[model samples]
Target: MLLSACSSAERGPVIPFFGAYFPSWIACSLIGVFGAVIIRLLFIKAGIDAVMPLRVIVYLFLAIAIGLLSSILLFGR
Candidate 1:
């Protein structure tokens, strides 16, 4: 029971759209996914995608990084 006190009481950032509150993380993640898709297209056009050994992991990390970075910058969390 004492460990529960260590948790933060502040609510996470949210966005209101169409009369509903949406968690900011979801928006950030969607942005990241779209960004990754665009990046992948760019990489393919530049002939960089073929050189990558682990494309899946690379894109996954890129998405997460973009998501977190956008979240921090946009939400200040």
Candidate 2:
């Protein structure tokens, strides 16, 4: 499969000095913020319920936190 081939490629080891974990956190935060904003705007424009925006944001944050924590615990210094 394509996925298997990609995994076989020689990706270098993770570099901790770059705050490798930080980028994941930042990306998660940005996605949560932007996604929430866009969803709220769309809901308002369409005159629908506003609760979905909050739920989406919360799920995004949770997912990101879980991923970051797992990575740190698995590859910590």
Candidate 3:
């Protein structure tokens, strides 16, 4: 029984919408993807994308960064 008290909490956030529940991470991931798209478009408009040799990899990293950032800001645990 004492060991139970030492266990780390794993209660991640959840959102209930339209009578359904959704994990918060999923929402953050989608937000990250959207942000990545906007950043990509901005880079394209500024003519910076043309100089990047690793477009796909860079975009993937951008999405991951945004996702992690959102998780930190929203979860903060």
Q: In terms of TM-score, which candidate is strongest?
A: 1
Clashing pairs in 3: none
Please give, for residues 1-77, the per-residue lDDT of candidate 2 as tens digits. Answer: 65775673654334355654343445445555565567557767887645456666565665565555555655451
Error (Å) of candidate 1 at residue 30 is: 0.4
The reply for model 3, stretches above 4 Å from the true place, is 1-10
Task: Answer with 2 or 3, whichever has the higher TM-score.
Answer: 3
In terms of lDDT, the best-performing candidate is 1
| Backbone clashes in model 1, listed as residue pairs | none
List candidate 2 stretches off by more than 4 Å. Answer: 1-21, 49-77
- What overall lDDT, based on C-alpha atoms, would model 2 receive against the true structure? 0.55
Lowest summed-lDDT stretch of 10 residues in model 3? 3-12
64, model 2: CA deviation in Å?
Answer: 7.9
lDDT of 3 by residue, 1-77 (tens): 76775565845588888999899889889989999999999999999999998999999999989998998998773
What's the count of clashing pairs in each model shown? 0, 0, 0
